[model samples]
Target chain A: MKISGAQGIIECLLEQGVDTVFGYPGGRILPLYDAIYEGKIRHILTVHEQGAIHAADGYARASGKVGVCIATSGPGATNLVTGLANAYLDSVPLVVITGQVSTDLIGADAFQEVDITGITMPITKHNFLVKDVATLPEIMRFAFRIASSGRPGPVLIDVPSDIQLDVFNFTQEEEQEKNKPRFQWELSQLGSSLIDRAAAVLETAKQPVMIVGGGVVSSGAYEQVVALAEKMNAPVVSTLMGLGSFSSEHPLFLGLTGMHGHKRANLAVHGADVVIAIGSRFNDRVTGNKFKYAEGKTLIHIDVDPAELDKNVSTHIPLAGDVKQLVTTLNERIKPFNPSPWWKVIWEWKQEFAVKPDGNDLSATWMLKQVAERTKGKPFIFATDVGQHQMWAAQNLHIETPRSWITSGGLGTMGFGLPAAIGAQIAMPTKRVIAIVGDGGMKMTGCELFTAASQGLPLITIIVDNSSLGMVRQLQQLFYKQRYSESLLPVPMDFVCFAKAFGIEGTLTTTQEEFLAAFSAAIESNCPRVIIVKIPTEQLVTPMLKPNSPLDTFMDI
Target chain B: MGHHTISILVLNQSGVLVRVAGMFSRRGFNIESLAVGTTHVPEYSRITAVMQGSDAIVAQVVKQLEKLVEVRAVEILPVNTAVVRDMAMIKVKAAQNKKLEVLQLAETFGAKVVDISNETLMVEITSGKTNTDALIDALSSYGILEMIRTGVVGLQRGDCSIYEKEKCEISALFDTAQVEA
Candidate 1:
């Protein structure tokens, strides 16, 4: 069983059920590359380390398993930070392995030596630097456990050059049996008693509304949420991160509720007699004008993270546990209420606040709706970068399952989509994967297209090009008196040419006919493809309420 | 303000001392002194830092420390009957100085001058906060120039270390139960 550290890595990955890894080989990681060559694990050589990490992230989101990425130390390791942070914010499970300098020369500032473990600590759930060859198997097991457990996140393991060259006997059974921390959802210990109290509140309330967040998605509790909502006969509003938790087409579904949420969604929250919040930390953006948000409503908060309860809005009842379990238990105890009257009132508001884009026949919003339709009922993963396109995708995409929509919510990290798409496609090869990105965001990590092409991941990327930072430009145009400063990127590179250079099929569309053709063609392609849709620069995401403003006060141009 | 025990795991790399010390200085967290050393893993190190701040401020400091990429895990360990120790190596000018007074002071504080030259005396002191402070105050009058103190290393008075015993037991029990099942 004596195997080199590099061989042990491949063995450990295979043990963890990892079939492929995204990485680029360098002098420091030559041993690992050689081992990969000798082993059966597929290695997708990315053009850049950032692309590797993003591809891994996409894979994790798409597959619902921990994605793996590898890179040499120093610059290569630093490049993965953005993608790591993206996965961290979105709660995607990822395991990143980086090659380090020799143990003896670790502190000598040797070539390609970087303190990756230290640098990645804040961005990772947990990280380890393997100095001893014996610890490699244990560390890899521990990394996978930590990355995939609790709130899923990215974990980094740095293996020194000397350790990679060292020999070790790593028994598969021993490695598999390596003990690690387990985050269990004990009903009693997690304060499930509060659910009874919350049920009482839900039972008596005249108008009850539900606010769901990304935690529901992370916990795979979308069905539970839908069931609870239907049983309660309550309208469900979602945070941007909570997109696709409830069927947008469902009668009980209220559009996204936040700073950029629909006016009716905000109004519904404000007018509710009782608010049942599940798996969502009431972030500042979601609770605009915090003092007045859900005014006079009895707030029943349910979250796994204890710190999130009563952190922003005052809660009458708080339940701490996994959202899925809590909702299922609550569904059994609570009595169903008739919401036809309340639904009628909310539907009227929804109709009044409904947004219809003008002039631009095929706007980004329209394109998203079309994409959602074309993909059919099969679960297609959507990874989005931040900007107008991200919000549009969140508002438009119909997510029927958990982990179907992956986007940086808390950190709002740009350049997240392309890399995340790469990860998702790798993780779930059978499903269609799409990266919906704005022009600004696409340019930030557009290089990852080459990574996608090289892997033949069959990921389809749709870039909403408006020749500027559309979100900022809209804000400046609407609120800042049209003083667009440092928001427009002049000499914008041709996206089609960029994708073509990466040896990937590319298309640019300016009209509805062209857009449909381009999108249809990209989806049919065997390899990764990019489709750029030219959008009007003046287009803005409508029904926008100013930050910290009441739901009643909104500006729509 | 109450005493807070901050446990930090860091990369066992050089310049870590300077970076950590500088953080304390810049943040003005009156470092009641610190103790650092390599852990069981050579690549990883542990540093126990003691500071006095309000609960809110201490939590803020812990959050800030956690934000540092170099800092691995940071937890505010509860200090109830904990064994905390600080070691200081002080070099005092012996010639024409109060050598007997310094030695007497050191003796009273259970400190010893390990190395002595004709003109300089190297005193090593390991004690609690009060004793360390008293020795520093007494030695300052004798022209104490060079002093290197190994911040503060501490452990709770218990049967075993937290990570070693508690984590191992829990994980072992879980593993055994899984295997048996």
Candidate 2:
């Protein structure tokens, strides 16, 4: 049947099992909004384009589906940049649709026209400018496929207004068949690349350490990761993205390894002779100094994206394929080994440098532990913004479920929590979604509270208000001889009042008991709630790797 | 760090070159010379990019290039076992007196004098980089006014093609049955 291009977009979305999308419409995208109104799909109108994009990212990460968002030309398109970069870095699959000026006016710098495809080229997995309505269906299909495929990322489709008004015949069944995966492309052949030798290396090593990254969750290799760790008798360390890929409570699991990673985990990695890094890109945050990182260790790196194999550090054995498949094959080939002696050293280090709150004061660490304890045994999800609180949560939160832990790992994006939590709550209506934000992070995208309240999402936003940019201050104190210039928030606006303005109940907690009570109440509430947990000014993420040092290096505590 | 020629097969489409070029600049790899054109299969295009980098950087260049959705295949051809060509047109400020010497020098390099005027002689050469550079050098003393090169394009020797063997497999001797198309 012949249909308008906007309706064809709807048809293509339905063909791909997408029943909902998050977006903010504008003048150039009126036709798309009209089609959305007539279509059966649910369209979430966020307060801002940034909120819409982040919500889609959160939806994708939480629901394991391709997240969709839309925006108009110029400012609407540019506002989605941070979210695009965030999704790109963290490998979240998002289909972003932007309305562009008419084809005749594209290069004329027409009103509200911007070169969105050019701007998003470096950040997105792939992007397209719909030259005509004829390719709309295929472009939409490929956009989703590319976004949701190997090493998933965000793909943008910039359709001109004229194309949205154009007519096209889009049959869902025929079009779907015609648009089957365009490429039989494999990043690398999953064979004897590093399997046999890597398994042998793990089995024979006296001190072997396995480091898991976000790839574990993406590949659904959690169970295999557990099995492999047990079979090799190697202690497992989780990257920021690999938080919930393995059970935090597992005896072999040493939580979060990186700059702000657990002290014992860093020591374990530094002392290991063999490092089996699975599904990790080894970003700078994880490697203190690339030259000094694992200098003598034999590195076995497995990642679905081959470009990331040796991008940061050289890999002794680069196994480029799906992490789940590679780890499963490695699991089958390897034999169990006894690491009693390794465990002895790990145990001593664990006892010597366990991750715990230093004092009894109401700190970020103290607040995070209380939040984690209050939400225990409940169907819960924790989404965090980047800051001291994020690091504290990574260091403290005990997550056991894959996809349960969602945060901006690679981009370390601020203002990601509120909209992300709203999206997660929408994706997982039955589960409790909580947003953990620092004062600084909350200030960046705090306006998203309007979205949560308007949608009536049961998202609990916990603002760990340190009254300062705590991480920046901590850094200055370490390097600048305690010259905490400009890092302090001299004018502290009342976050509780701000939350109340958004039609959400707000509470201020200064003590541990008060925080627990507020947190528990928020958990029970069906509507959005914001709790401001005031922490000490100097709260820091300790065991931070100093410049030009190894992972085990740190400043004087 | 040395230069390596990487040949890529990508779907003939707009914005594909920008994607490849963007990845190069984003990853800090330097493109010494690049030539792009359609292949015999009209649906696909070939991009011959010569990049300067270390072995690891070149490995990343090839790996990163293959990640593009439009890119079908990539291979780094060995320097010795390949036939490379660079097409250049150099316009030299030749007086009526020096035209024959420039012509004779260009003839030595198998160059054609495509255009001639009393003020200048335009010499064109399609050969390896060495021959093209030599022809330009021989005309430089005659006051070469302008010059342009079509970068460098190459194909592996013997029976193997980029589609049949990647990384310019020197041992692709047995795959003689598969045609280049």
Candidate 3:
């Protein structure tokens, strides 16, 4: 059947099982909006393009589906840059569609025209400028495939207005067949040898530590990770992105390992004879002072992407393949190994340097504990914006299931939590989604409260209002002799009032009891609610690695 | 740190060059020189980039470049087992006193005099990067006026071709391969 390009886009989306779209329309994209109105798709109009993209990212991370977002050309597309970068860094699968000027006016610098593909080149997984309506179907298909495939990330499609209005032939069956997965590369023969080498290393090691990264969750390798850890009797440490990949309550599970990671996790990594790092890029935060990170230990790195194999730390055995497959194969080939003595040493370290709150007062730590206790045994998802609050949440929150924890791990993006919560809530309507934000992070994208209220998302926004860029301030206090400067938010606008301005119920709580009460009330209300938990500037993420030090070289806490 | 020559195979599409260069600069890898052109297959292009970095840095650069969606494959051209060449055009101030010597020197390096004017002579050479540099240096005393090089392009010294291998093994190598019409 012959159909307009707009109809083709709608048909393709429905075929892909996409039910909701987060976007804001403009003049150049009017045809698409018209198609959306006539179609059965649910469209969400966000306060800004940035909010729309972040929400889509959150939705993708929470629901394990490719989240979709749309915007017009130029400024609208430009606004999605930060959100796109956030998704790219965290490896969230997203498909972003931006309207462009008519084909003839694309390069004439037409009104609201921007080379969005060029603008987002470095940040997106891939991007395309649709010059023909005939190619729309295939582009849309590949956009989703590329966004969700190995080491998923965001992909963009820039469509001109004329293309949306042009006519094209559509055949459902043929198109569906055309979009089937085209390639599945088997594990290279070399991979088998690499796995053998890894198993051999594990066999000889007295102390072997398994460091699970976000890839475990992305690949749904949690079960395999557990089996491997159990078989080897090695303690498991997770990266921030790997929070929920393994049960926090597991006996072998140590807390997050990195700059703000748990002391036991860091010490375990330090004393390990072999380090098996899976699905992690080993960023600077994870490997403090790269020269000393995993220095003497034999490193076994497994990832789907070969690029990540030797990008950071050199590997004694590089097993480049799907984490799930690689671990499963290792499970079959390896004999049972024991590390009881290693566990004893780790348990002692855990006791000697347990993560503890510094003060007895109502603090971020105290508030997180209250939230955790209140939300226990409930279907819940939590996201955090970058700051001291994020580290505190990472250090304190207990994630019970995979994909239950979401945060800006790679880009350290502020203003991510609230919008992300909106996306998560939209994806899983029955589950409770919460945003944990610092005063500074909330201020950056606080306007997203309008999006939540308008959508009636039933999300709970918890603002840890420290009235400063808490992380930077903490760093300056430790390194710059406490010469606090622009880090402080000089004029503290009432966050409760700010939330109220967006038509959401707001509460300001100072004590632990008050916070719990407000939090429970918000949960019960089943509507968008914002609770501002005021904290002092001295609140810090302790047991941190000092500047230019090794991962094991922590501050004198 | 030393200069490393890297080759990349990418889809022949718009903005791919910028994407490759953008990533290089974003990761703080300085590009010493870069040359790009279509390969035997019109659907793909080859980019040869020279950058100075440690072994780790070079490995990282190749790895990061490979992460780009348009890129199909990335490999570091080994210095010993590869053939490297550069094309350069140098215009020297060849007044009456030095015209013969400049011509002789250019001929010695297998350079052709492309253009000659009253005060200058333009010499073109397509040779190894080192040899091209040598010719330019030898003519520097003759008051070289201007010079432009096409940068370095390299290929392995073997019957095996990276492009052909990728064409056949793409389905067997990458998890996601673009289906050709």
Candidate 4:
């Protein structure tokens, strides 16, 4: 039947199984907002467009479904760029629908007009500016398909105000999808010869270490990775993005590997004779000194995204396909083997660098440990911003489920945690979504607290107040002779009052007991709450490895 | 120098060219030459890009190009197995006294005199890199005034099309990859 462009968009969203969208409405998007007001789909009004997009990203990460968001033209569109970039780097699937100026006024310098398609061309997987109402349904379908398929990423569709005002029959546009060109290089499952070759590499390994990355989480290959790790009797190490792919409490897990990675995991990769890299593109942080990264290891790299195969570090054997499929095939083909001799060294390193919570006056790691202990055997998602607190959260939080750990690993975008927790909580309502944010990063997007609190989301923002950019300060102290330039926050910004101002209950905890009490109360409250924990300024991410250094060589802290 | 030519078959979409070209600059790979034209197929635009880089970097580019949604297929054309050519038009200031010499030089290089003026001769030539550059160098002696060259473009010199079922159809491999080991 006939429908307005706004209704057509809502129809497409429903067709694609989208139940909710996050966006900040504006004058240009009034038509779409009217449809949203009258439609069945839920729309969240975030205080900022950046918060909306990031929440969508977090929802996608937590729910394994394509997240949707919207914004008006110009500055509203521009505000979504950083979030789109973050989702792009993390490979999170999103369909961003932005309102645009009228067709006649597009380049006429009308109010709120911007070249969003041109601006987002480099960042989005693909984008389209809809000038014709006949193409609305088709463009919307294409947006979701492109965003969710292959290597998942964000796709933007700029709907002009006049186009949204136009009326068209959805059936007419449905026929156009049949003629759309199919991508030939859409990731095809590779020939088993490569799998055979990979098995041969595994067969000859004396000390094998399986390193998983974000690919595992994105591909939902958690069980297969666990099976392979168990079958081979190998220790599993994850990159920052791979945190939730395998259980943190699993016996075989060796924690994160790379710069600021666990010493056990780093040393394990360094000592490995054969490294099976699953889904992790060797990021620069992970492959510090690519020349010396895996010098003697027989590296087998597997990734769904073919471009990532040898983009960073050269691999001896490259398997390009879906991680879930490849890992399953590997599990079936490779015979169970024991690497206990190698595990002897691994266990030694694990014990030597084990995380022990001692006398804690709200140290980042110690606070996270208490949270982890209290929430043990329970479902929780720890979303973090970038910094020492992010590393601490990754190291200390017990994420037993896939998609439980949501952090901006690739982009390391600050102000990500709070908004991300908002998305994750909305996606997984029953689970506790904790925003483990730093003092520095929280200031970037703290307005998202309004979004969370107003929605009555039970997200806990555990803002670690170190009164400085602790990670940057540590870098300066180490290499710059302790010249703390502009790294420290100028004033003592009380996060508790900030939360209270947003109509959310909050508490300030200076010690472990107080923090634990407040945290327990927040958990029992079943509503949004903020707990500001005061961490000492000197506390830094341990075992910091200088860039371009081998993983095994860390500076003496 | 690790110079390679990549031929891409893409959906004739409005932004496909930008998407393909953007991938190169996005990855920091300098493009030596790039040419785009319609193909024999109705909905396909063929892009031939020449670049200088290590084999690994070029391979990475090819892989990245294939990931674009509008890209139908990407193949790295080997220099020996491909028929790469560049076309150029050179205007030389061969006044009345030197017009014959310029004409004779164009003839020797099998270049066509596409345009002529009272004081200049514009010669057009299509050839491989060496011959194309050599002809321009030969005309430079006659005081070349202006010149324009189409960047390199070509396909594999054989019966094999990029769309051959044996090459493009991924199902056979997909079937094998799907079977339980």
Candidate 5:
């Protein structure tokens, strides 16, 4: 039963139910890679370590399981920071394993050595640097437990080269079992008094608006949220992180609420009598001017993390527990109540500010609508990068289920879509996955398309080419008097050529018909494909609130 | 803005101090004085940070600190109900002519003369903020040579401790938060 640390890692991952890992190999991690080469676990070699981490993040979001990734020390580990922070902010479960220099060479400034655990301390839920081979199994177990447990996030396990090569008896199950740390937080501790208080508040509310967050998806509480929303007859609005928690097609579903949210959604929150904020921390973007946000309303904040209760906005009643439990309890205790008048008011607002697709050539909005229509009544996953296209997708895509839509909400990291799509597709092979990306964001991590093509992922990447950083350009046009400096991509890059170079098929579209044809073709290709839709640079995401502006105030285009 | 003294209990792990400081700086909160040291439990470290801000901002800082995995507890110690102290050592020129006066002033402030030179006297004192300020102010007249002060460190006056369960067991709260998937 004796095994090398490298072999032990593979064994540990197998025991944790990990079927695949996304990683890039390097000098320090060669032994681990060798071990993986001899094992049955699938290891995806991404173009960059960042892409690997992001792909793992996407897999976790899509599969509802802890995603795993591996990298070598130094720059390899540094590149994972943004992805780690993204997962941390969104509460995605991930186990990131990094290879370190030999134990003797750790502090000697040897080649490819860095204090990765120190660098990732604030970003990860927990981290460990294994100097002893005997402790590897236990630390690996704890890493998974910590990553998937309460307020799940990425955990780092730094395995030194020597430890990986060292031999240890792998049959010490009794000792390893004893080392497993017992996580104490339980759902039963949530007392009934708070549920009673919340029910009373709901009973008295006339215009209630429920704010669902990513916590619902992370905790697998989608049905519970749907039940509560239906029972109360409340309009459901979501934070950017909360996008897929409730079905976007639901009648009561208002679109994404915040800086670039629907005009009606923000207005609904402004006029709400009771704000039931579930699993949301009220990001600054969502709460424009904190002091005035949800003012004069009874705030009921329910979350798994107690620290987020009053961190952003004030709360009248705080319920700290799992979203599933709290939502279920509320569903059982609270009676159905109709807010038809408020619904009518919201309907009027939606009608007044409804998005109208223009007849412009290859419009991103129109393309998204076509994709939504063609994919309607079917299961699909849409992942997006940050920018105008991201907002457009969130505002236009027909997301029908939880974990069906993925985007970088907290960090707003660009270059996230392609790799994330790769991850999601890998996690769910039978479902259709699409990457809706902008020119600016695609350029950041477009190289990952090579991974999708090489693996024959059958993923479609829709590149919304506006030839500029659309979001920042819009900001300049609005606030800087149209002096767009350093906001434009110097040269118009062609995604078709890039896709071809990566061994992927690509098509350029300048009209609605062409886009639909190219999209349909890509869907039929059964291989990774890119459809570049040329959008006009002047187009902007509407209903954006200026920084420091009140929540109710927005500059609608 | 009023100054507030807050104590944080954290797992004795690497880079935890940097994480706490980074959070404060990133959030635009300024720390007036800070001290960190191992506590009664070797597994825990107590970080005493003094910041000047409104009640809401201070509360936000505390909540953010509590979010860190290594941070086990966070408690804001009110001045009237906590024992807060700062230690300082001041070196002053004390020639034969002014030695008596310096010694007398030091006596009134309960300062200890840890180092004495032919022409200088180094007095060390551990006391609250107000007393330390007064002693420094009085000693300034004698042309103080050099001085150093350890930042404020505080603990609650009653039986309640920052590490105690009922006061601030952050891990316990997190454990309770873990719902079965």
Candidate 6:
């Protein structure tokens, strides 16, 4: 059956199991819009392109599938750049389709003829410029495969205006089978060898520590990492990205290490004889002063991307493969080593770095804990924007499995949580989806609340109102001689009024009691709910390893 | 860390050097040296960078470079068969009639005496990294005053291009592969 390129796109999406697509139509993408109307796929029209892309991102992070977004060329495509880059940095799977000008006018500088494929290349996992109708099927399949594959990210498919009208004879099943190839983990073999080497190193070490990163979540290996740590009787220290990989309540948990990490976690990593890193890139922020970070320890880094290993710190055994597969193999092969002294020392460090907020009111940490408890063991998705709220959530949230906590890790994108939560909720309607955003980050994409309301997704948004870019202000206060630059904005917008404007119930809380009530109400609300918690602007993320310093060289709080 | 050679074809424009350099620095990819020059094509320039990293990371870097808007193509040339060269200009203090001896040293290293003044003698040398190091070693005894060295520029011999290899791999998988025809 011959079908238009636009219909081919719809067909390809349906074949990929994509039921929902978030987008706004324009003159350039009218053909695509018409095709979508005729097709069975559900399309959610967002008020803005930013909202559309973010909603798609939210859906992807929550569901662990490729989130789809469509937009016209020029401004529509440009608007989605931030979200694309956001997904790229955080490694979210997204398929973005943009309508381009006619193929003939592509380089003539015609109206709405922006080179979207080129513009998105740096920010996407892969991209294709489809000029012919016949190529659409294969390109679309390749786009989804690339976006959802190892180290998932955004993929852009720019469909020319002329091609959208052209006819093609291609069936969905034939295209899928032809395009999809087997992706095996040959790297896992290398990973197994490295694991044995790591075990050997661990056997001789007196104090061993496991440093878990976002890769564990990416690989759905959180439980395996925790089990491996417990088996080794070792303490677990996490990077900012590694938060939620280990339970905060676990006695072996040593909190986050690196810049803005806990003091004791930094000390634990610094003093350990062996440091086992899983699914982390070990960015400079995590290492602080690299010279002093884990100076005497043997660093064993296990990551899916072999490039990440020894890219930062020198490693003894570099394991390159899937984190889950590697951990599972390691758990089965090695005998549990007894490290009683190491466990005791880690326990001491945990006590020393006990993060007890001075005020008894529902602090950021307390709020996260409450949410974790309320959600129970049932699979729930938690998304967070950047700043103190994100760190606190990571430190406090009890994530039992992977894909549970989604945050902008690599990019540290601020306006990521709410839209991501909406996406997650839309992808899995029955799952409880929560987005934790700070005042600064909330305002960045706060308008996304309407998308959630319109979609009828019962997403719970917890806004930590700090009235400033808390992380930047804290840095300025600590590092820049207390000169707070443009970090402080004017009087904050009324979040409650903002939520009401979107037809979502909103509540404001100041004390711990009020927070508890508001949280319960928000969670219980059938419709999308927003709760604004007023937090102090002066509060700083403590136990920080100051910038340009080693992780272990943390300022003692 | 083994050394690797990466060739990037970028749109000829200003600030491209800074943009490319910034990417390497931001990603923490250590660049031993980088050289950029105009290609045979008027609108395009070729940038050659020599860096040290694991094979996996170098491949990732190549993929990242290929993604840059200004970058048209990226080729990772094997180090063994590639010819890597660097250019250096150094000014050395010459007292009395010692200029003849310095010129002699320059000639021995296949260097040319570009300029000669009463107080200083400038020598220009273009050679591989090893030869450059050796020349610099011999000139160090003359109390080198000022020096400028361009990073290594490398090119592979013959027609065995990286793009050709990639195309071959694709072709091997699907016999119908014919450059999107």
Pairs with steric clashes in candidate 4: none
Give the poorly placed runs of model 4, Cα more than 4 Å off.
A172-190, B165-181
Angstrom error of the Cα, residue A70, model 6: value is 1.1
Clashing residue pairs, candidate 2? Answer: none
Clashes of each: 10, 0, 0, 0, 4, 10
lDDT per residue, candidate 4, B7-119, as tens digits? 98877767778888898998899999999999787777889999999888888887787767667678889878899999999999989999899899999998999888999
Q: State each model's CA lDDT, in order.
A: 0.79, 0.86, 0.87, 0.86, 0.87, 0.79
Question: Where does candidate 2 stray beyond 4 Å?
Answer: A174-190, A356-358, B165-181
RMSD of every prediction: 5.6, 4.2, 2.9, 3.4, 3.1, 7.3
Which regions of candidate 3 are displaced past 4 Å?
A173-181, A355-360, A490-492, B1-3, B75-81, B167-181
lDDT of 2 at A162: 95
Q: After superposition, how far is residue A491 of candidate 3 from its true place, in Å?
A: 3.9
Evaluated on chain B only, what is the TM-score of candidate 1? 0.69
At residue A120, what lDDT does model 5 achieve? Answer: 82
State which docking tier applies to candidate 3.
Answer: acceptable
- Model 6 TM-score is 0.80
lDDT of 2 by residue, B1-181 (tens): 8879999987788888998888888988889898999999886799999988899889888878877767768888899999889899999998998899889998999999999998999999999988888888878888989999999999989998777643221111100011010
Per-residue lDDT tens digits for candidate 4, residues A416-507, read 88898899999999898989899888889998899987899989998899999998999999989999999988689978778888999889
What tens-digit string does per-residue lDDT give for candidate 5 at A407-511? Answer: 999999988898999999999998989999998989899999989988889999999998899999999999899999989876878788999999988998888
Residues A1-557 of candidate 3: C-alpha lDDT, one tens digit per residue: 89999888999898888999999999888889999999589998888899999999999999999999999988999999999999998899999999999999978999999889888888888888999898888788878878988789999999999999999898674655656555654667788888888898899899999999999989899999999999999999999999999988899999899999988998888889899988888888888877788788999998877777777778888877667888999888888989888888988998887656546567998888777777777789999999898988888888878898999999989988888989999999989998999888888889999988888889999999888899889988988899887898868779878988988889998887788889879988978999999888787797798765777788885
Find the number of clashing residue pairs for candidate 4. 0
Clashing pairs in 6: A58-A420, A58-A423, A58-A424, A59-A423, A287-A551, A288-A549, A288-A550, A289-A549, A289-A550, A362-A512
lDDT of 6 by residue, B83-107 (tens): 7788999998887688999999999
Number of the candidate with higher lDDT, 1 or 5: 5
